[model samples]
Every structure is written in structure tokens, then in C-alpha cells.
Target chain A: MQAEPEGFDRVLSSMCTEPHPVAREAAERFLATNPGDPGTYPTVAELEDRAITMLGDIAGLDDPSGYVASGGTEANIQAVRIARERARTDGIESPTVVVPESGHFSFRKAADLLDVELILAPTDETHRVELDAVRERVDDATALVVGVAGSTEYGRVDPLGELGEIAHEAGALLHVDAAWGGFVLPFTDHEWTFAQAPVDTMTIDPHKMGQAAIPAGGLLVRDEALLDELAVDTPYLETTSQATLTGTRSGAGVASAVAAMDELWPGGYAAQYDRSQANADWLATRLADLGYDVVDPTLPLVAADVPTPTFEALRDEGWRISRTGTGELRVVCMPHVSRSMLESFVEDLAAVSGRTPTAVPTDD
Target chain B: MQAEPEGFDRVLSSMCTEPHPVAREAAERFLATNPGDPGTYPTVAELEDRAITMLGDIAGLDDPSGYVASGGTEANIQAVRIARERARTDGIESPTVVVPESGHFSFRKAADLLDVELILAPTDETHRVELDAVRERVDDATALVVGVAGSTEYGRVDPLGELGEIAHEAGALLHVDAAWGGFVLPFTDHEWTFAQAPVDTMTIDPHKMGQAAIPAGGLLVRDEALLDELAVDTPYLETTSQATLTGTRSGAGVASAVAAMDELWPGGYAAQYDRSQANADWLATRLADLGYDVVDPTLPLVAADVPTPTFEALRDEGWRISRTGTGELRVVCMPHVSRSMLESFVEDLAAVSGRTPTAVPTDD
Candidate 1:
């Protein structure tokens, strides 16, 4: 474990964005703090309140109901739990949820754990959910209509405003899975939050684009009062009276996420995304010149159709990357994936593609 | 966030055990490692396997299938989910889970989240679940029978061997939640694991009596092949094809638990617990001499029949403690609860109880 982390150095891991060094310091700062048991440690509770309020402001809610979950998986599962509890209170039976085929895998896990029927809404060529297709799936039994803010495959945000309108029209609650886009799109012109749509719940991860320490995923809901309905009381634990999905959790993640937000929010994060965007644009252009059909990136993530041989070669060269089931290579331009690392990756990619990659202009 | 932790200065927190400083070092070692997306991290995955195997051995498991959950809440929910999945596959509908009244609150949470009917089996005078009451609760619809090895209210082991036999006779799975008891019971002559009972699933927390860093609870099962039935595929993640409830998690908890185990496994932990037991016996005898009826401790946990005035007085003196709903003052004698601290606490209790405590003989 003390081998100096050769695993993550300059690795273009499509599944993750590199966590910043600030996240580590914050995690260490609260290594002894367990925020989950607020009764025992009140200081962590204050930090949790501050973190929630700050995230709520960005998500367009003055006061919000939420929990700092382990990750998107727990957040997504909790969102469904909230929706199901809401539906049950309204006398709905056998409630169902509709999610896009491009949605994160947690929806399926939630569907399985919650005993709810999950129907897939179709996606178009860009991998965005077809708004009309989703509308057709929302019947009287639909408790939630989920729209993916950024698909894991292509980082394409669905038409959340249209989806929200359709869900409201059908009397179904809308939840946005913005696990990847939440941190970045808040800085961009992308309309992906409560300001642009009437979202009942949303999944946001500080571990992803916010570059916070691990396990800092959040589930933010509209109203603060509805939380009483979500709690399952465990008389023994100081944490059981709350609506958290876990019992005793570290304040390390919450502290790190709040610390990252303090550093990144308002204006500092925009510059980080700008650098990632520049890297993605340069990489996409270079790959396109080599005859790869790359989906134009919306964030730092880019997906390109690559030959299986070339995809395998990238792995052999110690460049951490991922591929779709169809062998399309994906690159997440994290801060670690620098210009020099990209140049080295393309050199090996070119050898397998049987073509040379033309260099792109870098003015900045 | 850096408020100099007045919350945990040798305070005997009933809900927590102090994490060793070595645990903090372990967390720092992998602060940058996020093994949730395992494809990017080949090293952490291997370490996770090693840690799981080592924990499984201590739990008397030859080979186990499990996840390093956030804590007991997630692990208990997952165990119930696994039972429900197995029951549904066997054509049982509306699965029912029977738990002892002394069971942890996570069972009630799992019942709510997973849509299972949770039936509370009655406990006896000592707060141990009656074997007959538990036996009568199981039926054809039963998916799981939960037995707490050591109840948080009263640290008493239920007859797990008998409970397991009944569950097996009913063709139901038994999940033992040994979150607090797993670490210490192994050193004691307590029959709490696979060696004593046929448990399908078990919950253990390294952060609890194990004294690792925060959020290191695990759920271990008897068989390895059952994991395939539990996983939801995330095509983009390195761990996409595996079974995990959370998507993005820090590797800090895993590294710390492994490090803690390295420090405390076969013989090292025995010496630590012996000191705690000696401290508990001396304190309990001292309290009983003050005319306070104290429950004999089993695993460094003691419950005393303290008046409201004394309980409030102790709290006013800045000691962190918890009380049973019935007003029994509880003290979990963790490694941090030194002999001097217990001596001082008993002195305060004697003052509040209007009696003088007699000195106890201390012998190795």
C-alpha cells in the first residue's frame, strides 16, 4: 500500500477523474471524526450542514433535504427509496420507475433492491435519452422518470427540462442522475439542475468531477421537511434517527468535499474544467485526423470508435483506459492526463492504427 | 472543521471505539486510491482480496463472498437483499425476516428499504433473544433469521447455534450481525462465527471493536459463487462487472482495516482486550459497591442501572455516553477507556449516587 501509487500516475482512467491533493489533506484533517454519529461529534454535524447548504445553493435550492452518501450508487438507491416512500404514502401500489438506457447502472441496482419495475427509455445516436420515448413510458404507475445528466458511455446530458415537463405532466417525479456532470456543468452554460428543471431528487458526486476524496456522493431533494418521512429509527445508534443509508461513516469524505467546494466553487473550478476541455479538444482533433469517429465531448470525457487491436495496445502500453462493450475507446481527460501523457498515448495508438496522428495547436 | 476535537479526548463513546493511530497512517497511505473503479487500480483490488481473505479466516470462514461496505447499515441491508434474492428465486413471495427484539436497528431499515416484513422475536430478562421465540417466528415465507451475537443494549450473545438450526430447518438463510462482536469475540471463548453456527452471511465492522479507521464494515458469506447473483454491471468502471453497492469509494478504509489487522490479528489483539476487560471488571465492581446494579459485561460493554440524576450529572461533566430507552446507562469499554478514566468515572458516579465506592483488588 505504501509503494508510491504507481497505479494512478498519469492514468487516463475513463471511469474516474483524479482526486486533487486538497481532498487528501481534508480527509486526514477529519480522520478521527465520524459525522454519521452527530450526537457524539457535533463539529462534524456543523460541517455537514455547511456542505449541504453550499451544495443546495449550487443546485438552486435555498434549503434542501439530503445526505452525504457513499457514492452515486447509494445516492441513486436512496433517491428511489424516497420516491417509493412518497408513492406509498399517496396509496400507489406496485409503483414503477422509468430510466433511460443511457442511465447509470445504479438505477438497475435500485430497481432490484426496491422491488420496483424498471423500464428502459430509448436513447438516440448521441446517446441522449429520447424525450418523447421517455414520455411514452411514464404511465399512471410511474413513480419516477429518471433523466441522465451525463451518460457514462458518452458524457451526453439528456434534455432534462423537457423530461421534467413530461414527468410533471404525467404526475411522475423527475430525478436527475448528474453524478458526473454536477460539478462541471454548474460552471458551464449547461442547464442541468433545479434552476432549469423541477427535479424532485438528484445524484451528485464530489469524488468524480469535484475531485474530492472518496465516498462523498450526495442525494439532494427539493423540500427540507419531507425528510422526516424517510427516517428509519434505530434506537441504539446516534445516527439511526436520521435518513442516512449507512450507520457509522467517516467525516473524511464530507470534510474533503466541503474543502474542495470551498476551493472550487464560484470561479476556481471553471479554470480546471477549461484545462480539461482544452485537453479533450486537442485529443479529439488528433484522433479524428487519424480516421477515428469520435463523439464530440460535452465535458472532459470523449468516446472514439477504435479497432480492438488498438484498444488492446493502449492497455499494453500502461495507459489506463476503458472500452465500451463494442470496443470503442473512452478517455476521461483528468488533471493527471497531461499533454505529454496524451502525446505518449497517441504515439502507441498510432502504431496500432497503422497511421500517424497529426499534432494539434496548443496556444494556451 | 479543525476545532481541536474536544469531542473525543479519551471519552468512552458507546457508539465508537478509538481508532489506532496506525489506522490513520493506513488511511493516509491510500488517500489518493479510489478502488471503486477497480480497472484503474489493479493493486488495491489485490489488496482488497487479501484483506477479505484475512478477515474471513478470523470469522472462521474458509472462503467467503462479501463486500467492504460503508458500515453495518449497508452490510445488513445487503445481507437482507441477498436473502430476499435467494428466496424470490426459490419462488417465495413477500419475504419475511425475523429478528430478535435486541437486534440492531439496521434490520428495521433493511425491512423498510427492501420491502420485507420484519417480525420482532421476544427477548428474555437478560436481553438475549429467546430461542423458542425465534424458533416460532420462522415459517415458509421466512427469508432470513437474524441473531445478534452481542446486542448493543446488553452485550449478551444469543443462542446462534440454535437459531441457525431453526433457520436451516425452515429452509431460510441466517445472517449474523457481528459488527461489534467480530473483533473481540474471536479472542474470547465466544461461539460467534462459522465455527459455532451455519451462518449464510455475517456483518463485521473494523471501525467498531476492531478499532480500525472509520467506515470499514464488511459482510462475509460462506460461498464465493453467490457474488454473481448480487452484481449489477457498470460497463465503464473497472469494477463494473463485480458486486458492489457503491460505485465510487475511497480505498482509505480498506487500507486502514488491512493495516489494523496486520497490527492486531492472532496474539496482539488478545493483550489489548485483556486490559479492557480488567478495566471493565474493576469499574463494574466499584459501581456495584456504590449500590448501582451493573450488568456483568461480556465484551468490554457494561450497562448500569443509574438514576436520571447521576446520568445527567455524568453528561454535564463532559463525558460522552448513551442510555437505553429504559434509562440504563451504558458504557462501551473500548481500548481508549483506560483504568484511570474508569476510576475517575466511578468516583463521579459515586458522588452522584450519594455513596462511597470501595476499592477493588487488581491482579494480572
Candidate 2:
């Protein structure tokens, strides 16, 4: 296998093909220096407990138990599996899940993977699921109802409190797919919040809004017994002495998550969320002034309904936004984004709209 | 939520409580450096192809293919799901899987997850599955005959060739649980021989022998049609044109695997197998000569059947090793392990056996 060089050379050759050498080198050095048994590395058997405590603190759930998974998809699948088993235990025939039309597609995938029937609640003009529709869809056979804390298209927060109330009334579990908002919601200045929900479980992606490396999403259960129903262990790998859909988690990813949580606490997200919201509001205002129909003008995510030609024109003018199939463009503002990036996007937008001529992007 | 700074003074604070400032800086730098469609920043589409190509390369198959999963456990579940459908298609009354007793326990877990009957077949004294027993277990109700390449405890390679042939002769599919040996066998200097019978599927773990960062494993299928039988997709995240499961994969993990493959192919693992095998062989001979009953003296992995007193004695001599329930010590020789480590292990064994230590561990 050693053509003419050594193992180190082979490693270097692989590194060359990586997207970012500096980042890859940094990642490699980080791995080499911090190689420790994650089970005991970050403090022994308390790894899972630590994750649980962190989720509780973030979601404002006084008592919660977290199960780390590879990503949001697996976490969603595990949540569905637990819900299905709960329905079976409750003597429900043909368990059904009530999910919003705007909910992550993982909802349907989870239902399919677990062989449970999925019932998608219809959305309103703004793409928010209709609370009345969700209430009407729930029945005695309902296993679980999903509420998206942050919809992918517009980053719109759903009516979790209303949905949770409806699902709980039907004797069904209310699960929140908060993969993008868990790290941000705690810092929101709103009042009637997610903390008021009769929610039973939630999914959070540390790799997304939390800004950690990949493979570090989790499913947090308000009722730990629910997770117990899905617990599985094998002889090759030690899982939560109960049940788990996946086994052999990467310790490196676990460490990164722990590291991400430690960094996110203590008002870290307050500043990031505030800046992001401000930028999004500004972008929405600017785009609307340019005659685009903006959704939820005050939100930190701007979705503008524009024709394909307008979108291509903006792209030609150097904007990197995406166009949804329904003639909407989504612009996300993360912490890494700067005011200058927004200004540049706006300048390009203005030019595309024929309202300005060759306005240069500002640095500030 | 920002609290009073700790003793580490916001340095470890940034790393522990918040996301890595370093990775954020890298993402920022990457955004500034490549300021277009952060979509290229590892999009769902790119991840889909990368996963399919990566899994295909591992199983030696082609595309319209597999999906990225959490690990071998998830992969096994997908494989079993497909096999079950295949049985259903053939109208089997009760689909049964014939698995070697020495196979990874995940196979059993997969069967249990899918509600399929499992027939455990005994292996020979060397821990290889007995072909005659496997042949006897296959019937019209058989879905898959599972084989192991290298077992966890004894590191014995099953006669995959004979087992594959028997499964095919019985009109059953052969699934090779080569999670451990997949990366090893393809690169080892040992004879390149396997029974020429068609292998329907295989599971390989890049996290282990492939030396990629964890949470990278795959299920490969020879006939891509099997994936279609189990294929389920969602709009939130795309899989291959056909897939077994669908969701947004950990893009960074998929990127890391691509990097790992680039490091492993064409000669990456070629020399590693040579060094590891040499070390294992040397350790086996030394242990056997010192009056220890080494399991599979001819294989690259050496498991020594020792008394409790012998184990305690070795532990006292400052040797750290794995132990099976049956008082057997197991050692895995991998690429990073130096030969001197093996020599030192041998010397420790000799001393524990009341013999003089001839070799000392090299400090390298």
C-alpha cells in the first residue's frame, strides 16, 4: 500500500484534498492532542447526564434527560420510536403522528422508519400550522404530535403551546423539533414562550444554531420513561442500559458538543441572537423597500417572494441566497455574518432592482 | 444567563460553555474566502452524492444507491429492513436470518428491531462459522445468511467464500458483517481469496480500522435494487435518487470520510496491514512459546487464554489490555501501534510466566 512514501505522506495526501487545509489541520491537531476516552474523558458516566442537564437549562425544562444522537434525523427517529411504543403500550391501534406541513421532513421519514402513520396538519398563508386544523386532526389513536420550534424555510417559530395543549388533550405526546432554535430561544425577549408548553420531548442540533462540529444533535425527553421504552443495548457496545436506535457514538463529537455547550452558556447567545435579529430586520426592510414581498418583517430570517428572473438577476449581481420552489428567497443571519455582508447583499439587490447604479459594498 | 467568569477566565469558557471560537473563526474565514452560496459549504445535495459514492466504493457497488447512517448499527438495521422486504416479496411465512455466533451482536439487534427470527449458527474451534451448519440452517424462509470476516473476540475470519456459496445455493442472500475486517482484508498482504459466491451486502466501519474520526460507517449492497426495496425519502433532505432512509446527514462527517478515503486508497492501507500483521504474528509466537494458549495463532489477532493469576500478574507488570469474559486477553494490532509495543507485551507475558524478559519496549 505504500507506493513510494510513508503513512505520514499518505495522511498529507489526504489532507490536500480537504476543502480547507487550515481548518482540517486545526481539526487534526485538536483530535491528536485531545484524544481521551469520552465516556470518562469529560467526566466519566455523567456524560449523558451532563447533556441532559444542559438541554434542561436551555429549554427551561426543570427535569429533562438528553440522549445524544448522530444528527437531527436520528434523534427524530428515536423520538418516533419511543412514541410508537408508548402508543402500543396504551393499547392504541395504528398509531398516528400529527405534524405540521412546515415541520422538517424528518417527521415523515421518522414515521416511515418506525412504520407509524403520519398526518400532516395544514399551514396558513404564512406557512404556520393552523392550530384548529391540528386540534381537529388529533384523535384517540394519535401517538405523538410534532411542533417545529424553527421552520427551515422561514425560520418561523410554531405555536408550540397551542399544539402541545391539543396533543396532551388527546393523550398523545407532544414533541418539538427545535433543532435550529434550542440554542437561540432561551435568549429571545418574548413572553408566551416554549417554556409554557406541555411538551414531552424535543430535538436539538448543536451543530447548527449552536455552531459546533457535526454529529452532535440530541433528543431530550421531559419524561425519561419515554426514552426507557425505546432503550436497547447490544453486547458489542454499551448503550444507556436501556434502548437506543443507534450505538457507538463518536467520542470526538461528544467532546465537541460538551465544548460547544460550555461556550454557549453565560449569555454567549444573547449577543449573537440580538445581532442576528437586527440584521434580519434590516434586510427584510431593505428588501421590502425594493418591492419584494417579505414574510414576518420583524423576524431574524427574511423570506421574500420574488420571481425567478429577479432572483437570477440578484445572483448575477453577486448574492448567494436560495430560491424556494414557491418563489421565495431565504436569507439567514448567523453570528459569523457581518453588517458589511448584509450591506453588500442589499447593494446587489438594489442594482438588480434598477434602483441604483454600481453601488460598492461597504466594509462597515 | 451570563454569570461571573470562572477561574479559567473565559478562555476555556469559550471552548467549554460556548461553541468553539476557533471553528467559528474558521467558518467566518471560509465564508469571507468563498463568499458565494454557502450552499457549497457542504450542501445536502453534495452530502447525498458523497455518501452514496463512499458507500459504493466500500461495498464495490455503484450509484442510485445507499444513504449515510449513524453507524454500523443503523446500517445493519437498513440492511435487515431490505432483506425482510425481499423475504416478503418471496412470500416467506417467517423470514429467518442465519447468523454466525461469532458475528457482531448488531445483527441480532437488527433482527430484533425488524421482528425477524434469527437462527444462530455455531462456529468452529477457531471461531469461524461452520459452513455445514450454515448450509443446514438455510431454508425457504431464510432471508439472509450473515457471515463475519473478523470476529470481535478472537479476530477469526470466516470462510466467507463457502458461506456465500451456501447461502446462494439455498436461494438466500449473504450479508457480510465485516465491520472490523473490511478495512483490513482489502489492504492486507495475506492471500486475496474469498469464496466466489455473490455477496449481497457488507457493513464496514471507517471509524475503526479506516482511522477516520468516528460516526462514519456504511452498509454496501452489490445490487442497488435492495436499497430501493427499503427506500424512503423526504423533501426536507434528499437521499440518492433511491435510498433506504432519508434525512440531512452530518455533512462534515461525510466530508471527513471523503478525506479518509483519499488517505486510504491506492496504498494508504497497503503498508499498514503489513506492519500490523507482522506485529500480531510476532506477539502470537512469543506468547505461545512462553506456554500461553494463544487463540488462532495463525491470525493477526492473538487472544491468550490466561488464568486470573496470570492476568493480575500482567497488570502488575504495567500492561494494559482487553479481557473477554472467558479469561482470555485480546490485543488488536493497528497502524498506529509500534512493533516495540508488541515486543514489550511479549516480554511482560514471559515475566508473568516466570521466565526472564528478553525484550524491552522501545521508547519511540
- Give TM-scores for every candidate, taking all chains together and pairing residue i with residue i: 0.95, 0.79
Supply candidate 1's per-residue lDDT for A72.
Answer: 87
| lDDT, candidate 2, A1-364, per-residue tens | 1111111111100101121223233332233111122211223224446656776778777777766666676788778878888898899868999998887766766775566899989888867789999988999999999988767777767788888889888999888888877777776653223367777888886656665555457788887788787655433221224355665554434445555566656476677778878888887877667766788733356687766676667655545556443558776666555578788777766656565333332211
In Å, residue A290's CA in model 2 sits off its true spot by 2.1
**Best by lDDT, which number?**
1
Which pairs of residues clash in candidate 1, taking residues 3 or more apart in a chain or in different chains? B39-B238
Q: Per-residue lDDT for B3-81 in model 1, tens only?
A: 4344465466655666777777887777767667667776666667767887898899987667777888888988898
Q: Interface RMSD for every prediction, one decimal?
A: 2.1, 10.9
Q: All models: lDDT?
A: 0.79, 0.61
Which window of 10 residues has the lowest lDDT sum in candidate 1 chain A?
Answer: A355-364
Best by TM-score: 1
